[model samples]
Target: MNFFSKETKTALQAKEAALQLAFAPVAFQATRALRNLGILKIISDAGRAGISLEDIVAQLTLSKYAVRVLLEAGLGIELLLVNDKKYTLSKMGYFIEYDELTRINMDFTQDICYRGMDHLEEALITGKPAGLRELGPWETIYPGLSLLPPDIGKSWFDFDHYYSDIAYPQVLPVVFASKPRQLLELGGNTGKWALACTGYDPDVQVTILDLPGQMGIATQKIKAAGLEHRVSFFTTDVLNENLPFPDGKFDAIWMSQFLDCFSEAQIIAILQRCMASLADGGRIYILEPFWDRQVFKSAAYCLQQTSLYFTAMANGNSQMYHSDDLIACITAAGLTVISQNDQMGMSYTLLQCVIK
Candidate 1:
């Protein structure tokens, strides 16, 4: 199949876009300053009438000169509008200040990615997470999530939870559609999805499979939620081919925002393993943000840029995939796509597959 569609622009527009990319750092900092200095919130609170420059400086306790320069920079970035020497929040600026998705993305980019991204080139060349050294001594971020300094770990979890949590409510019903007696959750970080599964269907037994270190956290959450009996744990590297799933069969396997964390070969191995453990008529449900299936260019742009984060910080080999590419991997693993659910909450797509 041909590659999925993308928005295109003329040469002049593309040139302007290139210039914007070149100055992205300046814009990033300016946007942060607008929020940090209370400039954006102040204008947003003032409504359409806007707020005068003097009021912004006075409320923020900053020198007029500094405030003026920042406001001008904000204007250049299209985050603000100035009229009659008063400022108002632009659509982008309002979203920056208020939207949960924007806030989570901003904090994640600023706290987790900003510095590590500097080594993106080195990572791409070596095919390793070269930037991981900036945060901790680990081959990848997953193994060291618990050991990361408290603030850094919070940033990581916040970024991770924010994305999946928003989509879980909508995803829960879809996964329960088959009403399977036993459900196996792969990459069950922190046990949120497993907990949700048990909560969704009290009779359904869940076995969560992930690394031991990650299981440490997920186990705690399971116990805390009083789900220890319903939600079981299976700790494995997942890349280890020797030990796959348990002897017991699973009726439905759930992988939520998980496979994109691994390389293509790894994903295929994991799926092939699942195919071995799953009952003949069982299904595999995969929830992911496929860049090509996104409804908006901005969401797709975020997914593509997140691929760089994988290169530099998470794991070098894997990335957010387009639907066509990921489906190809599933087919290669001896699975057939039977149905799909897209636009669940935001950016997520659910693919339901069965044995080929």
Candidate 2:
């Protein structure tokens, strides 16, 4: 301790500073670029056979210098190795190939996040979105999504897949254990949640309501799961439209990961509709992201902000609102929160409310 003096402490601090610089994007983008160019795909496909820089350059029409530069950068990032004349992707570079659950990291990054990031300062200044109008024409972007590069489509689908897997399993027990007979899933994407519920209890009958474009996926999955009789799909624009079911039709109404896609007024209107649709003792189970002051200052918050921005741009108006605001809305809509739990690392909350 006596030998450790102020100068040594200062030197140690400098060492720590140098280590953090290794995680910078400049240090990683080279490997990412190579993966984007299909070099990684060639290496992954070749396996023990290996590949050469000449093969990559010939296959991709990239210049030799460019290929060398990318490989060297990948080497620097530990994603590649240069053995004599050949350059091959390293084991770590194979990670994406095994990412089966998939996430929309790249699509959100390219379609919405990268551009929204450029306008973060504007969003802070106005307390409003910056890239809604600037988001590329929806008519052009959405219809062509399936035709976009495979990586892009996988990225988009992966995002939903990740959230669904992570968030839905935690909720299955709660929904089933509640012992509800008839269920209504509002804006349930592709009927994944409905299938889970019906699978858990043969007695449970579920109806899923979602956008017209998403109904096909829901119906196909529901029918394939052999729950066609118990689970059904209803295509309706929930934001600017009325509930398709009459009052007291469902024993439980599930609004998983859906209510966050609207403004406060819209959430309140939806809650009112849910109240009317519920059987007297029927409950509404809501799952949504609930933010606080700390979340407002995080990079993760930027994702939510960008999501709301793009959603409003694409669908007219959608948003992420506070849970307290929602509780208030539920109360005002004549529903009582019987129980509420926050899960999925507090990015989402589940509330079981009954008509009061």
Candidate 3:
């Protein structure tokens, strides 16, 4: 009766993969070294003919000894193929070298997660963003976004927008369907959605609600676009139970990649406050990458790992939710799920809800 079953003829391969996981940290460092030293590029340029270790050393300006060690590691990791003493990039290596998603994930991991992930155990125990202290003294990561090192901040924002920006197009039409006059962008990081909204319709006024630090960045970006007259910012931390939702009964509220940053109880509270503030007939548009809703196993795997970032560096108690759990929150908050738009770019799911 079990619907799930798979052949175990690949059992040996599974064990080998598990072994790879055990040495993954070192393998990751080696791959990073390969990328930074242009070893991958050299091997890739060599193409199917491959490049000898000496040639790799000559091209990358590295010592022969370093080249041998890194190349052997890459071979073991399957990032390189060695034949007749020449090395070539594997298919995986090609993606690591040129894929935009791979670049974003690598940069995000190195800049935002590497050190912080070490504190994951402590974060889990305390139910707080313990690793955020690595970046600053702030209790949470949001307030310190503006203070992060320039390169790290760039990686962080790149990872953030890369996913949401792609979904904006699909969501914009659904949001403006009723032709909302006043739209509230909850947790509008860097004012991307707000800018898009105002640009889509000059008549639609946009107000952003986020932490003061984030609002500062959002305000600058909105002003730079010369849409300041149509867009505004309100400072508030949703985690603060006392900070009620904006009094502005906006005709629409947009929360993209926002609710996943909080625990279920916090999500319920936020939704309730949103329902109270939302005007009659207005809808709350929720954009999230629900792992359980992902069609590809690789996408689900990636999202499952991203949840750890929440545990270690972001808020400790939140994660990439399952669609079922999110729907539960909506229902518990006295809201209706009018429809769910799936297949959004980057495996995102948009849930459109209105007050019950």
Task: Using TM-score, give the best candidate's number.
Answer: 3
- Please list the residue runs of candidate 2 whose C-alpha ends up more than 4 Å from where it truly belongs after superposition: 1-32, 39-61, 71-103, 111-155, 241-244, 291-313, 320-322, 344-347
Computed on alpha carbons, the lDDT of every model, listed in order, comes to: 0.87, 0.65, 0.87
For model 2, residues 1-356, the per-residue Cα lDDT tens digits are 12223454477787875774665446545555776777778767766557787787778778889877877777766776667666655766666444432114544565544555555566546544554445543432333334445665555555545554567777878877868888888876657778778777889988887766667666888778777889877667675554455446788898866766665677778888777778767788887666541233442464455455544333334456556777887888778898877655334567888877
Task: Please write out the lDDT profile of model 1 over residues 307-355, one tens digit for every residue.
Answer: 9889999989999998888999999999999988887767788899999
Each prediction's total of clashing residue pairs, residues at least 3 apart in sequence or on different chains, is 0, 5, 0
lDDT of 3 at 332: 93
1-356 in candidate 3: lDDT tens per residue?
A: 11124655488998988899999889988999998889999888888898898877777667899989999999998899988998999899999898999889989998898899889999999999888888888877888888888999999999989988998888888889899999988888888888889878879998898988888778888888898789987888888879877784789998999999889998999998888778888899999998887777777877889999999998899999888998998899899999898878778998899887
Question: What's the C-alpha lDDT at position 134 in model 3?
Answer: 81
Model 3 stretches with alpha carbons more than 4 Å out: 1-9
* Candidate 2, pairs of clashing residues: 102-158, 103-158, 103-159, 104-155, 104-159
Which has the better TM-score: candidate 1, or candidate 2?
Answer: 1
lDDT of 3: 0.87
Locate the minimum summed-lDDT window of 10 residues in model 3.
Answer: 1-10
Off by over 4 Å in 1: 1-10
